[model samples]
Target: MDRDSTLRVEKTTSLKAVVKKTYVLDTNVLLHDPTAVAAFKQHHVVIPMTVLEELDHIKDRRDKTVSREARIAIQMIDKVVDNASPQDIQAGVPVPGSTPEDVPRGTLAIYPDQRLIGDADVPYLDGTQDQANDNRIINVALSLQAENPAEFVCLVTKDINMRIKAKGSGLIHVEDYRRDRVLDDIDLLARGYEHVEGDFWSMISEVDTLREGNCTLHRIPRKSLPQAYPNMFVHDDQEFIAFVQRVDRDFVYLRCDSRDSLMHKRFWGLSPRNLEQAMAMSLLDNDSVDMTVMTGPAGSGKTLLALAYGLHAILEQNKYSKLIVARSTPPIAEDIGFLPGTEEEKMAPWLAAFDDNLEVLHGTDESCHGSITYVKERANIQFKSLNFMRGRSFNNAYIVIDEAQGLTQFQLKSVISRVGADSKIVVLGNLAQIDNKYISPLTSGLTYLVEKSKAYPHAGIMHVNGIVRSRLAAFAEENL
Candidate 1:
């Protein structure tokens, strides 16, 4: 942020027209969203030198996912502040706004938090131990707040504890970085179905019925299902279900479905155990839908449904040449190179759920092991770690990404973009089972996908909430 550049940006910017707030970001927020430095739009964005040191250390970590994000954040910061001198960097650097069409309003600066002096006016946390990095970053925000009493100085992070500490330390404005959040409440997320109190037709006063090939289509006024989107399902208590084929400004076109038809649908040797599974299976079987996002609680049978559909598509329908199963291994599991056969062999432990599903599908066979082995070979099933899935395209393949609640939006996008023509992807996640510390049910990539892709013509979404694993499993899911 050279003096001339800073003055030029300040003079030209319009959105800075609003009350400008200075935001000091934590290291976790950068790892969560690599482009967060520019997210402030017209406000001033500050990065503590301690955060840069943290990124420098984490960029070489064993966890490829976090390390990759750290590298990206460092690169973005470098791109913004490269032209500025060290002294200029401490002041600020000119960074681009959302688009070049909009005059850039934000200037990113690196604060030398370590060189803090004992200012009696500002309250600073001891940085010697106990989350030293977090304390230092909070100190920067405190320093900024004390220096600019008129302006709003805020600290943004994903860590709940850090936010608490900042607020306890007398910072008036502390916030979670919500630039990536798609919803305010996780429960407000799309469930792909609307369960009307009674029969669906009871409330519809006006409707125009038509036929499209073998499917019956009904055009209802948009006001009937005001919040409807494409691929959404509407069900009645009396057993009627309709798939929302498409939506427009004036109308919602629905394809009528019957409970008997959906329940009768089979994948491999498995039939729908419940309506939720049936709805999910319906999405999986739709050839026009290129992607499906399935989410539920544990023991809801998401993995089983995806695997069964993949096998049925490959073996019976000949929909694709192979079935590829992949998921993000725990960060520690990335060290499988220390004890592995092949990538597939190394990913076996993480992907054991798919095998368990296979056993359920072929448990009646005379030799269950033999049946599983034969199915794996015959279907060309491959187990892959999410780490190695980038830079590759799978054409004419069926892909299932399980346990996706742990992924960030950017990480999921990188994997989803690898889909080639003639390929379909089914993303499976149990939001309640999310393991990533930085992710939550509301911020999970699976949640983002469900919200963003619900209206996409070629994508489908479903929530299979039924716990069909066992009575004890259902009890635990509800009570424990």
Candidate 2:
């Protein structure tokens, strides 16, 4: 019954360093995320000599994005080891961020693989072999493991082959850099819609119905659909469909609609071929929504949907002054000035999909080519690269960012911020078609944006589930 008997507590005044493990980072890890050094959190991070040399070479790459990321990684390292002596750098320097207890969390070190000495007691990979830099990095991890036998040593890389090779070389701990990984399974990625079995209304035992001008609103208890977020769609097998208009702490407000209304919505003379496209078209036409992100497999008509909406908004509705279509192009391809007339002309090669869609729109005209040309001029369409999109604002424009899967969060954020006054941006990507070497569906910027913006009222997300391109194209998307 005594106060001391209920709970016993003891306090001790003791402090110990948190650097119990050493992590040798690969060049790709740094390129993937420039700020990866600080992610180790309370552990020792090592930048191998070979990795630094790789970064130095890549800093001047023709690819601006890669070069910028490499430069940022180098600058981050420099900022950490600014005034520290060579010995201190080789040993360990305290990282910038501190713990809540006002203690330095971790330390970063530069492991000079070139100065490594071979010992018969240690197992080291051949440094002069093919993949010499990779071998050197693995050797640094091996050397650390051998020298500090009591401490844990790990080789962190974004390269699957490097991980396999490191494990084959007798390194016990090797892992991928997962600081940017938002989901463990790609299946769990937000589809921007929820499918309810039977009738959606059957689950809601009680609801408050109200009217907002020309629209009908239903306020359902948050528990009925706890997973609901703004702009999400709830559909039932009985043809019931409603768009989530907004969400509050206690209830969800849904703007009721029918499948027929969404399907009948026309965009630049293009009608929805499926229910998913219908939802996407509706979202694009909503003036209240500033951004719409669409993700699905190839041949799902994401490009066509975005293009049709841009044309409708610019040419028909007079919603914006210009229609800007942009996408992330390959680095060598991005050197577009070498080949062409104007920036848009240079970009024509990469943005040919929009032209294809335009052709689809004007194919029935007497002179298809003339019709396309007239549409381009009438709509004031412009093609721009994501690289130069920085330091500029696009006002009163409808922007379409295509092939967004290959972008990182930073790249996507910069492009999204370029959307100025009265501008609406639609980001299109196929997660399965991500071609970037360092990104996967779970870490892709498209996935990042979809997950991060679900709670925002002005943002909408849609994943066109069906492949409506053609029978062969759909076959390839499903089976190949």
Candidate 3:
């Protein structure tokens, strides 16, 4: 071979060695996580022009959560291409990073198609019309796959249908962005309680007990402890229950006055009907536990228990000045059009659960009706929209977020960030009842929070098992 041809062959070999897989991102992936752009690591990222158009449509939406995410994705792309000439953008731009080492090694580019790549026409799919945004995005992936036959190309999206359609189109590489998912197996997640074995009471009886107000603290050998969090429940077959106050290399400290005491303690005229509920009550009543996540099946009394504890903290214990209740307003069957009112007024429909629980707490008698009104007036309770909670801080308040399964990890972080000094936040959700299309039981904000915050000193997580609402509800939960 000629010397020049040998050099050309070496250059081509080097190029092939350094070639990285290109990931074409869908709009849903960006909306689900704004930081997904940075999550690709060293791989090339392609933003389809169709995705940008969809982002443009979503950027102006009234729903700040998704709208803001869309804007962030747009801004990130803009910033990357800010100083680059049109020609440079046509090739690719490097993603910005705080440090050179932090920067993604692969290039980022925008794919704008003047025409479809091949003779293959877009296929008709149910629930999606021809020439749909998802179809166009899939075509971009297909085009990339065709152009770079040697390098791998994948379509990343949160939408399951998009993944299915991409696979149907013969694009084998399709994946759900899983950076925010904490656990793949739902059963492996924390259940908030553990069964003790072998002379648990005698083990505790040997420890030094210190009584401080209503809570008694004891320290036992760390080896004797079960896997537990700060406010986790430790119980044996003898009906002995204790709260994990703290743990160290040598010993475990537990806070408890008497066995089964929390179950008997009444809050807002309600007592815990199950052992899990009792554990939840103990964590809720403890002011030291600033963050709590409760997960269970429907009719497990998760919300009712959390609300009762919030009221008790606000009205009775004076630990917090106000009780603020919020819930994700995900559409159940269909969205009821735009609401007309202030934030709290707009949230009234979504907060019907709060009112129903309050009514139950106050009773339905004639005299009780008057008392309910009086309590409502004096409770200093407020309803908040999660969208409006961004950039605001809450101090000396008990914040309860219901229907947390509908929230993404980013949404949960935004809500938790608003918790200021001397404030506590309780997250309640049924993982099986997740309503959000973009999230799953494993990827929901509640699951992420519980999994990540389990090690935090002031955070407690509990998964209530037994359904206490009714026998029928329990049967339905089991069978259905």
- In candidate 1, the residue pairs with backbone N, CA or C atoms under 3 Å apart (3 or more residues apart, or in different chains) clash, namely 1-92, 1-93
Mind giving the per-residue lDDT tens digits that candidate 2 earns over 445-469?
8888998898989999999988777
- In candidate 1 the C-alpha lDDT for residue 401 amounts to 94
Per-residue alpha-carbon lDDT of model 1 for 1-480, expressed as tens digits?
A: 678876664446556356867999999999999999988877789999999999999999887788999999999999999889998898877777643656656889999887886677789888765656899999999999888989999999999999999999999999998888999999899998889997889999799999888988999999988999998899988878899999999999999888999999999889988998999999999999999999898989889999999999999989899999999877774576766599899889888899999999999999999999999999999999888898899999999998899999999999999999999999988888887888888888889999999989999999999789999999999999
CA lDDT, every model vs. true structure: 0.90, 0.89, 0.80
Model 2 CA lDDT for position 479: 82
Candidate 2, which segments miss by more than 4 Å at Cα?
1-19, 98-103, 129-131, 211-214
Q: Candidate 1 — what's its lDDT?
A: 0.90
Clashes of 3: 0
Task: Show where candidate 1 strays beyond 4 Å.
Answer: 1-17, 99-104, 129-131
After aligning candidate 1 to the native by TM-score, how far in Å is the CA of 342 from where it should be? 0.6
Tens-place lDDT digits, model 3, residues 67-165? 888998888888788898877786878776612684446667887854554454433232233557888788878777777778889989999988988
For model 3, give the 10-residue run with minimal summed lDDT.
120-129
TM-scores of the candidates are: 0.94, 0.93, 0.86
